[model samples]
Target: MNKELEHRFVTELENNQNIVHKICTLYTNDKSSHNDLFQEITIQLWKAYPKFRGDAKFSTWMYRVALNTAITLYRKSKKRIQTQDYDSVIYKIKTDDYDDTEEQQLKLMYDAVKQLGDIDKALVFLYLEDKNYSEISETLGITEVNARVKMNRVKNKLRTILNP
Candidate 1:
């Protein structure tokens, strides 16, 4: 709202933009849709910034807001065409040092992840980000034990999707 708060919000958003980009990549299918989602998420974040009490870390709070915005908008944005290839995608689901075999496996895993439900996809994304159970729980608004249980289920689901 005010200049100081706006400056702080912009600074924080810039620093943690990767989180938003990653969410947009997973939730969107095409470049135009991805840009639209990113803009919507940024607007939502700006609108809600005034209420950010900073009780948790800025990134942590951001995860909640960003994920929520993605899930909400994704449903409304179903008109966007779902493209298959994301090679030019900005935030790819890739890990450094992945060999050819690992790269193929990663593609399979990414496809499986893309097919997942919103909460399950969020759980896997957080897990891949190396967020501990506590952080995943906090970000997803679930208890730690619930997070673990759901993660286990998501893993099993992914395994089934990948194998079959």
Candidate 2:
């Protein structure tokens, strides 16, 4: 990439690195996996940066690229391991600021979220981030109607998991 483009990409990426972190946290269960996925997403973003047309917000474009990377490129090499009901593996990175009750509830929610399939998890993540139907549709390449429907289903699924 040329200097101007590189500078722009770095500045934007630095400013919006939280998008990458959120995606990584949702997709990876452990620190090693999280770091690996983060690195992978960053590489993919760098490669695709030249194609970004700036027709959308930089953060919006970053969401699409990061979600695509998490869903498609990053995968665990080991056979999946069975985990406990409230797995702490994923929550290890969380700060101790949350009291025990809050932490337990959060862990349960995270565990429930982990049960969702990749695409559904992406939808849930977007919903939790307060992304509207249009933004979620654009990011995931679904129609707005489909995004709304899918988000409803995801919400229902989460409720079932949390309540059951």
Shift of residue 56 alpha carbon in model 1, Å: 0.7
Clashes of 2: 0
lDDT for position 93 in model 2: 60
Q: Residue 129 CA error for candidate 2 (Å)?
A: 1.2
Tens-place lDDT per residue, model 1, 12-126, is 9999999999989888766777899899989999999999998999999988998999998877666766565565556666578756797687777777998999999999999
- After superposition of all CA atoms, the RMSD between model 1 and the true structure is 4.7
TM-score of 1: 0.84
**Against the hidden reference, what TM-scores do the models get?**
0.84, 0.84
Residue-pair clashes per candidate: 0, 0
Which residue pairs show collisions in model 2? none
List candidate 1 stretches off by more than 4 Å: 78-104
Report the C-alpha lDDT of model 2 over 1-164, residue by residue, as the tens digit: 69999999999999999889988878777777788899999999999999999999999999999988898854453356734334443456646775578768877887898788888988888888898889999989999999989888999999999988
